[model samples]
Target: MTVIRCPGLLNCDVVEVPHGLRLLAADGRSYLLRGLSADRLAEGPLPAPLAHALDRLGLLRAGPTRTVAVVGSGRLAIDVAEALRGVPGTVVAELSDDPATERPGGSWQLMEDHSPSRLTPDLVVICPTDPLGLRPVLQLCRERRVPAMMAWCGPASAWSGPVLTESRPGCQNCLDMAMARRDPLWLATAAGLTGAASCWAGRSWIAGQVAGLVAAGCDEAAWAQPTWASWTPRGHSSAPLDPHPECWWCCQSGPAPVRAESECSAVSSSAA
Candidate 1:
């Protein structure tokens, strides 16, 4: 019933459980606030990439809109949604009380459940597979046949999971595989820190990375972006487990495994 607005942003500002959204204007820019705490609102002057991403999303638009929902409603999601709000469309975010509980212990096991039936988004941005989350997302992308991007950087082994790196000149997979694999402890360390303090400071960087990947896919879906072609493996067929016609992963198919520039053209961008 109560509508509060700010700067050039549209949102509900009533702090406690936000009766509505508010938009605020500040030094030549607008911002939106909703079901958020003062601390998050104050974590201002967001990263440039993220701010650019927000501006692109139209953080100042008002009215109903079609939206692609982000699965994890973390601080990144909050910021992303705010940017989306400015757009002429909605950015529906699905939040759950417990994320860890729903996710699988093993990343692979978790991917098994990455089915479309489990979601209802025009486009879904699964958290990226960093040293922390990639294994599962990789497996899930294969199982769900969902296209995902590498959000977090990790051991080459993490990168080696199943996405498409080509072998035209050579197999980056084999190259990555030859490198020392990361210990589980490393995985934990990469995703470590799970509360507020980290969210405002460190986590945003990682989240911004993931957010960019997600938003890219969303934009591609919304606007038929051209599919970059490939000479070796076809796009989306980049999974390590995927049967490349001449993949070294399955067989020593190619001659001494030529090194392809890790462009991963095979893993074409397809967001849904």
Candidate 2:
């Protein structure tokens, strides 16, 4: 038995297959190298076949988002909005509790309470300090037929998502159900925890990861798949969000209608 570990390079098992040398990627993918022309293989200490395998496995891909509406008056929400800055054509706005007191700031717009009714942005991001407090926001997004993403940043420096998206598969209710099932005491525990804490103690890096996902989803990029990501001592791991067949929230709602360009054109208009 032989094993090779390249720090920041590749982690795999070197196995002798009938086809010659093969690399079983840490992600459960296996790549085989049969033969490579001399020129095709660059001048590296690693064999051409192994180098080719490395090249095949090493690029990162992400999606681009356009317009996004952020809901919530917490630090996490503000952090997410800030992260969207500098992306071309990406508009970030906050839904204010008081319309009269609200003022627009750099790179972000401010909207009154019923902002959702006015703007049909590509995606809505709800980042509430109390993850359980998103019922109303979730309901509004559902009624408006807009796609939404939710995030929960909490103490202990742990983060969950940019959760699932509202439209394609997962809904807030579905997420609730899943969380409930995953931990029978989740509701009680979360309530108690949030009740005692005035502000969430989530770490910046974790929040940034989730925020990036929210922005990408808003961009409607190809790699934008709804997932539940969590950070642990080992590292970060993600799992796909699945729809529940008996989800009352989603079942009751029909597919979001496609608003004509003219109707959605006034997205930047007043919520009044």
Candidate 3:
């Protein structure tokens, strides 16, 4: 992976991405330094550097469900699968691209050739190291009228859990559009997600925390709205997702209609 210096005098932490390393600064600024040979930042658009920095901070918002499909690999995926094992009244599916890859422990199925049963899982947890890998599962879940959550636990003490769906206000696409609108560098960062540098590692406690959130969400726990939840050394925090005015998912033909129903409740009932 390529290593690069942060332009400002900011405290930067290195985290693995899909292809290369991402430098996350203390100021909530992030930059993708791709490839081992690539160094110096390329000259680009006006205010690109400033915009990239601003894209960093913010709690991700989410909503959740039941009958989960945990889409990911490595330790985190295995941990989540194991944690969800034998939970009464819930069916969990652990999917991956590789068919013959040995799973650590828990019930997992080959996704390449398997078709889900008619009783599809209503919730999907996306934790794949590759950000682009999220697309297929999300698309599949959306087609089945299911909700998907983006979850991860650290190269350090941080964890994020955000739920997404095209039919509602808190979908990942909405989050992306909102971020892109706020910062010009967001689009560029998104494009490099799959090809950027990333590593596989996280703390056990953090993983457990994420898995618990997923489970609690599925069990219809106290989280009542589309909220972004996270954990740090200090404590836990959550915030509601704000729909973008021009979001295609929330506002298709015209302005989005006022929804009396939460995304999870509405879609789960319909899918059921």
lDDT of 3 by residue, 47-72 (tens): 22232233333211121225677777
Best TM-score among the predictions, by candidate number: 2
Q: Which ten residues in a row have the lowest lDDT in candidate 1?
A: 226-235
Candidate 3 residue 248 Cα shift, in angstroms, is 1.5
lDDT (CA) per prediction: 0.35, 0.52, 0.50
Candidate 2 residue-wise lDDT at 111: 25
Model 2 global lDDT (CA atoms, 0 to 1): 0.52
Clashes of 2: 3
Q: Over all chains combined, what TM-score does candidate 2 have?
A: 0.56
lDDT tens digits, residue span 1-272, model 2: 43333322234554554535455666787766565322222222243233333655741122244677777666666766666553333577766423353524321232223654556666667766565765556556666666666666665435554333343566555666676667767666766656333333354554466445543334445335556666544466677777655555555556444444321222111111
Deviation from native of the Cα of residue 169 in model 2, angstroms: 2.3
**Candidate that scores best on lDDT:** 2
Sort order, lDDT high to low: 2, 3, 1
TM-score of each prediction: 0.34, 0.56, 0.51
